[model samples]
Target: MELLDQYSLSWIIGLVVALSVTGVIAGLMAGLLGVGGGIVIVPVLYHLFTLLGIDESVKMHVAVGTSLATIIPTSLRSARAHANKGNLDSALLKSLAPSLLFGVLVGTLISGLVSGLVLSLVFGVIGLLVAANMAISKEPAALAETLPTGIVRHSIGTGIGGFSTLMGIGGGTLSVPVLTRCQVPMHRAVGTAAAIGIFISVPGALGFLINGWGVPERPPFSLGYVNLIGFALIVPMTLWTAPIGARIAHAINAGLLRQLFAVFLFITAVRMLYGVWA
Candidate 1:
């Protein structure tokens, strides 16, 4: 019994260490790339949950939910840093808010009905496409000279929100590319997307909280699908590093940033896909 207790204690320590490291990386990614760190957080949490012997049926749900919750603070800090640097587009942010919220609601509802495998598939496929685009086209041509208005803009915002929620992202991965395609500069797009993450994460997290309220086999200290322990473990490190990341984003070359982001995401996506198939 003593040996078993030691083994369990060791596992707990290792998990905590891993989560701390994940938080650091996630914070950097959120600030540097406007990704809200959800892309990094979700996968790491999923793997950790698996190691913890969480039930397979709800593993992805918890990961996604917890990721959205963590993003709230990281995105807030990242956006504030970018705003201080005059990188954010306040007008664009205002226009997209309503539709983004709407889409998050739609996504949360969908999440409740899907299997963990399906969510993993969505994450892998989208991650690959986003990575490929970033890798191949550092400076994509503009599709329009200015941002769209009315129904067109709303539709795009809705899609970004829905997809991001499904993937446990902050909408930066999709929004940055779309903004750039509309003739927005890379840095501005990135900053704007960081703000956009706020629109997605708050409502998305709440939705997950309500959606998973009574689910079985959740990790200890979970409030619905969001694991409080993971949130607590990850938030502090991300809070500490996120501002630093935002500063680095402004200093770096835009093209190099895209390439680096692409490489990291490509590896992550490939690994996620392999997990799905394996």
Candidate 2:
């Protein structure tokens, strides 16, 4: 009871409702598209923390870090669901993991050195580009008969790791496209992307932990950029909802889902960009 007094009833209730909704949506998208919901989660968190009067300087970091924390469990659940369907490319995942890890470390370190406003601007720009790419890109039918070897695979993995860490995503947005370009089947690409999220998040989250160490003026229940409260609110619900998303993905038309996702990305990007300049 005493501990409860620290929070306002209205704020607590709002947080619960908001986080619950976010988890459900994120899970649905992740399961359906094999992309972690960081694109949605990050902006929502940014706005929420702003409303809560968290210091502006650390708000973006908190949002990104907390989103990564949530991705850990959510991505694991998604990967498992896809794996059960025998869609994961285990060989490819193994080949790319090392490069991904190193890239995540570098990205995380760079994130700490940058300003929050700069990060927000960058996210906004990237969001726009992702939305544009998804909206206009034609669906390719060719499939990669063989997995990438040696230098090319490593280079791609590095890009996935670095971009994912910087954007607070699970790497699916880029990974799926790259895999598709390499001629991997759409479903296989989604499953492989889900697997990549786990690889990316482990080290990415660790980077946030190390980068934000001992920073003053951080919120309560925070470790560097991550807020434990937000993580606790999101992870369980995201994990439970992921498999459901996967099931829906199998049922839904892929073209429709992609269009819907693109629209959502556009809206999110516009909102974030508006906030950056406003």
Candidate 3:
């Protein structure tokens, strides 16, 4: 048990403040970096749950599920902003939708069976990889002149959705890399990936809701694994800030921003991994 388990007024105030900061940063990353903010949100939620004395068996599940739920609104706001800026790749998004949904379903099912330790490991490993890539690569050269199709498309789309669901992220974290590899410009890659997040998040969030139903040891005000209070507090802030990130993404160079974010991810990833071994 932790100090916050008592849920005193001071604890409540502290929680709100923490959640508010999380939402603001998550939203900014969603719009500015094309990630659904799951990368940021999941670890934050995990630590918060730990502080609240949430059972280790279900804390990671709750974190992932709740992160997915939050991505829905953030993705929508970010995607729309990207569209307005003429950065979205609609054709590619349409082609990938079905597979993404299928993957989310599959991932959600798997999450129900996996232990919290395993989930933490997965998040940590993926976060480390993503952070390293961002920190090391100044420019990702195009490997192909066009988007993937047929089996490749199916594999990539499904993988993006499944992996993202498992990690509690929107598709952007993976899809942006894939798109850039396919020769999509940075702006369009980010924009299109933002749209792809919608496909992954909507279905992923619902799948988590159903998957977590009747599960034991969930935090208070939880509907399945999604904490209603966290959802409520985070959503409004994310929605308000996402578009601002989008505007900034379109207006300026993001290389420095990516570098700074990579550093943050690296630290977060290490902490997550350490928690697993500890």
Q: TM-score for every candidate vs. truth?
A: 0.86, 0.84, 0.88
Whole-model lDDT per candidate: 0.85, 0.80, 0.84
Q: 156 in model 2: Cα distance from truth in Å? A: 1.8
TM-score of 2: 0.84
Which should have the higher TM-score, number 2 or number 3? 3
Candidate that scores best on lDDT? 1
Give the best candidate by TM-score.
3
Model 2 regions lying over 4 Å from their true place: 1-9, 31-34, 140-150, 243-260, 274-278
Error of 3 at 204 (Å): 0.8
lDDT ranking from best candidate downward: 1, 3, 2
Residue 265 in model 3: lDDT: 87
Angstrom error of the Cα, residue 194, model 1: value is: 2.2
lDDT of 2 by residue, 3-107 (tens): 357667786677667767777777677678656688778877877778777788888888888788788887797789889999998988888899999888878
Residue by residue across 1-278, what tens digits does model 1's lDDT show? 75345347676677678778878887787668656578878877887877778788999999999999998887897789889999999999999999999999899999989988878888989989988887785357789998899999999989999999999999988998899889898888988998999999999999899989989877666899998878898999888877788899999885678689888778877877887789
Off by over 4 Å in 3: 1-9, 29-34, 243-257
Candidate 3: residue 138 lDDT (0-100): 57
Which residue pairs in candidate 2 collide?
A: 143-183, 144-183
